[model samples]
Structure formats: C-alpha cells, structure tokens
Target: MTEVSNKTAVDPVERAIRRIQSVYGSWNRNTSVAQMRSDWDAAFAGCTVPESCRQASADGVDGEWIVPADAPRDKAILYFHGGGFRLGSIASHRDLIARIADASGCRVLAVNYRLAPEHRFPAALEDALAAYTWLREQDFKPKDIVLAGDSAGGNLVLTAMLSLRHRGEALPAAGVLMSPWTDLAATGESYLSRATADPIHQRSMILALAKGYMGDGGDPFDPLASPLYADLVGLPPLLIHAGDRETVRDDATMLAEKAKAAGVDVELKVWDGMIHVFQMFSEIPQAQTAMAAIASFLRRHLRLEAERVR
Candidate 1:
C-alpha cells in the first residue's frame, strides 16, 4: 500500500489554508447550504486544463473525459471526483486529474455525476455503471482501464466494480481509493476520534447528507451507498489510502480487512497525519508525497514500473 500522506512541514499553502479555516472557514462538513454552494463554486470556478486536454463525451452518457496530450501506449483512468455525493465535479479536480494522467501514462476521464439530496444512491451507482459500460463500448479493454476516486467517489468506484462483476463484465486492471467513506453507518470508532481531525466531514455532516440523499428511499447500508456491506468477492486488486487521524481511517482499515477476508487482493495504506481529502492539496509538501505514494501503488499493480524511472 502506498503511504498517501502529506506529512511534511507547513508551507505557505498550508499556512494560508490554516488561516482561512481558522477564522472564516471550517473543515467540518456541516457548513450552511449557501456557504457550501459558494465554496463549491469557488473551488472549481477558475480551473484551467492543459491545452492538450480536450472535452470528450460518450453516447447516452452524462460525463466527460480529459484526454492528455501525449497519449500512452496502453492504459486509461476513469476518475471520479469527490464532494460527499452532494457537490464537486471534473472541473473542480482538473489539476489533480492532470497529475494522475501524467503519472499513470493513461488518459484520465473524470466524471460529473449526479449529486445527492437531489439525486440519491442508485443514481450515482447507475451513472458509474453507465460510464464504465460506455467506456467498454468505446473499445476500452478491461485490463487497459483503471477506476479511481476520492471520498464518495471512491465508494462509487467499488460499487461500480461490484455491479459490473454482478453483471458478468470484466473489471478494471486496478483501483485507487483515497479517503473513502465505506461505512455510511458511521459506526467506526475512528469516526468519533477523527471527527476533529477530518477537515471536511464528520458524523453530523454525513447524517445530514444521508437524510437529504436517502430521504426515506432505503437503508444507508443498502450495499450500494455503503459498499462495506457488499460482498466484495472476485474484484480487481485495490489500493486504499487513508490518514491515520482522519475519520475514515478505520473505514479504510476495515474495508481492507473485509476485502482481504473475501480473498480479494487489497492493500491499505495509512498516512501519519493528514485531513480528509488531503491528496488534493498539491501545493502542500505532504500532499505531493501522498500523491507519489498513490502513483507508486498504481504502477505496481498496472505493471507500469517504468513510470517513476522515466
């Protein structure tokens, strides 16, 4: 497992972030509806993709692809952005996606899936399945593609893999999940202790989002929303990254155990100290270190050993 943690000294980026969060902002997932919307808009407002990157669409699908300039010989990354199932988009994660594309030597196709409180569990699940199927229909071989996501997106990646397996389809070559929310039940002990450490999510925030998304639709442990309940048998090799002090630390650890128990090849990495979605802060020293860990993990499973060497 790659140690996807940014455990370095504080820098300007971290210092500025600390300042903002210390006074006006908060890492708690319980921001007001208006404030959250504003933050989300600002997060993705001025994103700039590379010139070689272009917009791509598949037939009857609702997502786009971020094709890199120098196309790799053989590999593709189907990336999913994280916003607790309620917010976030491909545009919001352009910089991170670019890094993923460059590191994996694969075209990164990020999703702008439907959100929660408006669109529920199966909606995102359905979108993920549709996207995977569309990618396959476009001639992407199972072994040529990899599925990766962060937070809620991570959960969806697994759900999609399980659904594809259930439908008797081929799985991706590998999968990367960062700070995944595997357990919507919020029963993990880390959820309590790490609540203070988690910058963007807490039990209260999750419960609120669940209420908005579930809205009496079904149980939170329906195996789709919270993949920890699913039978994760015969899945592809998985690499999970978590922060030891984060709320979902145990979530990753527990999911690793469950997947291992099911005989699936799984690796779980716990970083020393970081916050939820810490991998996004590329400017931070620890974030870069964490991204390298993830890159190494993907290389190991995908046989792209020439990556870092190059």
Candidate 2:
C-alpha cells in the first residue's frame, strides 16, 4: 500500500481522529447497542440537512432525500450509511450526503436500512435491494442510478449488485465505496499492519461487529454476506476510497484487485494519515478532495451535464 506522509504535526485530520476516538473509544462489548446507536447519532448531531431535503420512504424502508437545487430529477444516488450494520442512521450521515449531492448535482436517496443483532444478515441487504427496486419503479432507469456506501454499507452496495445480476436484473451505472468492509471474516493483512495506526477501529472491534451482523449459524464467508469471496464478474464500475491508517485498508485494496481481475472497472484510493470513512469529517481537507473525486466519477458514469455539476 502506498503511504502519503502528513508533514503537519497536528492538523484537522489529527483533530478529527482524536475527536472520534474520544467519543467512540470508550465503548466496549458491555455497551448496549441502543446506547451505541444514540452516541453515534449524537456525534454527528451538529450536521444539518439542507432545506430542500425531506423525509421519504423507499418501499417500506425509511430514508431521506438530499436534493441540491440544481440537481436533475432523473439521476439519483442510492446511499447506505455505515456503522457496522448495527448502528448509524440517516441523521448521522445527512451532512456528508448533502455535501455529495451538492458536489455531484444529483439528488441522493439515503436509506436507513434495518440494523443488525435484531435484523441480522440479509435484512439490510433486502432493504437495500428493495430501495433500489423502488427507485427503478419510480422510472429512474438503472443507467441513471449509482449505488454508494461506506464500511458495511459498502458491503451492501456490492452484494446488491451481485444479487441483481444473479436475478437477471439490470445493474446500476456505477458504484462508490468508502472504506468498505468487504471481508466479514476480517482476514485482510492490513488488520495486522495498520492496527496501531487506526484510531477508531481495531481487529477485535471489527470481528465483534461482524459477528453481531452475522449472528449464530451465519457464515462469515457467505458470498452474500462477505462479498470479497464472491465472483465480481459483470459488476458495474467502482470507485473505492480507503485510509492508509485503517486496519481494514486491505479490504479496499484486495477487493479492487479481485474486481479488476474479474474485468470490472475499479479505482482505489488510499489516503495517507486518514481514518475509516474520513469523508464524514468535513473539517479534514482530504475529505473535500475525496468528495470532489466522487462527484467527478458520478457525473461521468451518470452522464450528467457539465453545467449541472458544481
């Protein structure tokens, strides 16, 4: 993995990491899932949804629409939030989605898929597929839709595409993943290499989250659950972002390699000194750069007009 050196002793990236650690580091196996969900939402409570955005439902799944004023009505981004499947909500990721909508000039449909430990494996995947199908039913063609997500949500993006392809359904134009946890088995080498560098997530934490999502009798290597083991042939173009310091860094790298081998167009970026899903922190300059790259990729794949993109 290529590393980008951060010359600044203490910068916005460091501060953001510290802040996240301060809030999330205290949690342990003893912490209740409800409390963790509350804490997670509270951490991003300051984020404000745009006035144009509104609460909406995709099929029966709860979600919100993030519509930039200039965004076209036809093209849309289907978003899934991260938090290891058991946590995160539309509220926690509203700001980041809003920024993406503004940058790409496409309305975003951010869904709050059912969480795990209660919903378990296949539940979130079902919700994601339902949302995508709902969008298709709305007359949004698959060519105009893009699937995007972070961490476990990124996992859903891949699985959703695979499922659709298996069912002989039309696939979306492209996909964008941020620090996707493709391997629920957590067997990536970066778990050992970047363990000390990643402040927010560790091997133990990842494994626990994975287990909770999988539950008893669930296979960690199941292609639907852990997409790294799945056949990636015929999947859409992908743009993957990862942090050099993240323990799951290899998840992004390995997936990109495998997808490319399977003839899928893949672009992988490993940001130096960044943490998992660093794009959530707008204060970090790298976050802005990553968002811009996302916009560019989406605009190209979605065939959005240059005048429409900001």
What tens-digit string does per-residue lDDT give for candidate 1 at 1-310? 8777788766645563574365336435577655665576565444333624656664454566666556664666888888778777776677777776665555777777777767777888887887888788878888888899998889888989988888888899988999888888777899798877666567887777766666675688878778898999899999898877677788788999999999999878787876667777666677677777777776666665466444
Candidate 2 local lDDT, 1-310, one digit each (tens): 9988887567888888787877678798699989989998888865544537788889999988989886789999999999999999988888888888888889999999999899999999999999999999999999999999999989999999999999999999999999999999999999999988888788998988899999978899999999999999999999999999999999999999999999999999999988999999888999999999999999999999884523
| TM-score, predicted candidate 2 vs. hidden true structure | 0.94
Please list the residue runs of candidate 1 whose C-alpha ends up more than 4 Å from where it truly belongs after superposition. 1-35, 44-51, 308-310
**What is the alpha-carbon lDDT for the whole of candidate 1?**
0.76
Can you list the residue pairs that collide in candidate 2?
Answer: none
> Which ten contiguous residues of candidate 1 have the minimum total lDDT?
43-52
